[model samples]
Target: MGEHCDDEQVVVKKLVNKRYLLFKIDLFVLSFVCLQYWINYVDRVGFVNAYISGMKEDLQFKNNDINVANTCFTVGYILGMIPNNLILLVAPPRVWLSFCTFAWGLLTLGMFKVTSFEQCCAIRFFQALFESCTFSGTHLILGSWYKESELPIRSAIFTSSGLIGSMFSGFMQVAIHDSLNGVRGLEGWRWLFIIDFSITMPIALYGFLFFPGVPEHSSGKSRFSMTKYFFSEQELQYARRRLPARDESTRLDWSVVPRVLKRWHWWFFSFVWVLGGENLSLASNSTFALWLKDQQYSLSHRNNFPSGIFAVGVVSTMLSAVYLYKVARSRHWHVATFIAVIMCIVAIMIRANPIKPSVMFTAQYLGGVAYAGQAVFFAWANIVCHDDLQERAIVLASMNMFSGAVNAWWSILFFAATTVPHFEKGSYALLATSISSGLVSVWIRKLQNRDSSRKQKLSYIDANDMLDEDDDDDDDDDEYDDQIAQNHS
Candidate 1:
């Protein structure tokens, strides 16, 4: 009875410790991660939000100009993904991310001065260079702090924060257009930049102050100075024990090339996101906003209507995250993949048939459910690459980098703004992408499952071999004892 009680006490203590550490992480780390990602989206998506708001008219953009500008951002965005994430290995996120945020905020402010399309593209390119780290960088940080089982929801929350930013961007644009249009002899679209800068600087400032670098290699001093003491020494030990061993280093070596190439993770996860990003071609296409615009809806209607899609994205992202964490638990990533595929079909049907605008709008909103795959796949990659921190960082960065690289051209070919409203070609292309995404996800999951099974089998065989050796030694001992007894006789 005493032994059982002791075991129970140990279990309870560990549970309490987990909760306590989680409290610290949520307060000090995830707050900045989520908020910065929020600000990141608001700024990154601000142009599209504003394009529909008034920038298109203000700049006299011809056909396909919005997409051309977006492509510039995508190109510039992917350029630094690998390099910047690599920087996180040598530099603390507090320093690296903070500086990037401040620079990006400055660039956002620069958007306030652009009067032409060329100028807009130039500023956006630089902004993308600065903002590239936000997505993959935060995923790496979240993976660093949270355990595997705990990651789905946290990852979901992180991804959802961006959609929340997007949701905010839509509503804020409407508000800005309503109240701030011509307030300072500037269009409301321009004010989006000003407000974005205001929001971004504060998030950047918070990150500078409180962003605990990586949990494993935290600085003795955060800008907050007290963050290091948040976890008890014992609790910190348990936290580190929960995660895989990570080597801390600043070395950049060519050996990283072959190491990354040898892993299925780099090639597969990165490719998976290319499909995932394409699976989301409909939302990225901004079809609902275009349909509203094509129907000559008011700027408020266009901006406000698309907000529903982002709203659905936010809810679906969280729900999927919770489902994965509590129920599906990642043995069923295919379920999420198929959900994405279904969303693509819905988009295709809406585009193909002469559906009512309301029905089409419903289809588009439902399509936002596909965005959940972002949380799903990214968290899966985090799990797969958890053993090596550098690989984790590289795979995470390359996933987004490769996706954005494909999307630069992918958008032009399939989702061009010039092809707005109907977007027949893009719809079919999106459907094709769904097939690819589902197939890849299924195959990858199967391979991972096989590998896990193989490892277990090897471990079992090794254990049995040891047991057999022990039995043989026991027989030898028995024979020797008998010999001695006979001699005494």
Candidate 2:
């Protein structure tokens, strides 16, 4: 009884230690990545806020320039996505991610000095190269430290930080335009860039000082050895053991290309996001602000009103996370279908040509529900591809990479600045993408079920084979015992 009680006490203590370890990971790892992503969104949307505030007039912008600049940024984002994620394998995430953050911060500051639309495009293209790291790279890192059960909420929080940043950017731009418009011979729009740079650099430094790299590769001897400082040896080992077992034979090499190409995970997930990315046209393409501008609203109203989209996004994203974690059990396809339904309603509301301001506002804000899929789908991928570290990294990156590739042309073709105040073609396109994404999500669920069934069958077969071998051994032992008895007689 004493030994049994002691065993129970040991189990309780281990659970306590594991909870403590998770707290530290949440504090040091999750917090830094969240902040990094927050600032990344701040910088990304800062360009949009700036354009509407005063940069449009200051830079003498014309039709299609905004679309052209966005295309440029998307191109650069596409170029960097896969390579930057793969780099995390060869490089410590803390170092590489921090360096990218700092680099983008510097480029954001450089945006303050742009004199032409062409120059802004040039700077944005380069800024995008570094900014591309946060979304997919952080997903890879989150998958590294979190279990299947722990991922949805963490991913939701991570994604919501960016939405908060977008919301904050609008408010920040409003404040900066009101106070800092003419300060230091800079327009309020330009000040947005400078302030974003200021907010970004410190987060980069924090990541360098405290962000733990991958558990499998954490070593005390590395140049920026923050993992050892933040985590104990036992905690680090527990972190490794807590995750789903990885295939040790899978190495990060050229062979990974063919391996990923052959797998349904890569193809299905990549195509899902490609369709999913376009589903974001209403909010992502800044249609609210464009319609507001076309209606000739004040600059402050323009910036402030559109933030409602992100505000709704924040609430929906959090709620969806809770639903996914507690109720849906990571059935992301349901969330995807729900988003499609909501977005389809929004697109129809807009396409129906409602003149009422409240109607437009409701439709636009409801569009934010689409942001919920960001966390849901990525967490689903992480859980699906959890067994392969290399595959997880590549698939996460490819989802974003392919999405960006499609957006490069899709936005210009569908949600161009010229098409605002109605965007009839864009509306039709959004409907198509939303329905297609829903269908693809259902297909993905079927594939996942099939794979799971296959694995279960294999496990059952192996277990029966082992049992058969044991029975044969027992029969041989009995025969030997009978022969020994005969010899003795």
For 102-132, candidate 1 gives per-residue lDDT tens digits of 9999999999889899999999898999899
Error of 2 at 228 (Å): 2.6
Model number with the top lDDT: 2
Per residue, candidate 2 scores C-alpha lDDT tens digits across 59-86 of: 9999989989999999999999989999
**What's the lDDT for residue 463 in model 2?**
17
Off by over 4 Å in 2: 1-16, 328-330, 456-489
Candidates in order, TM-scores: namely 0.87, 0.89
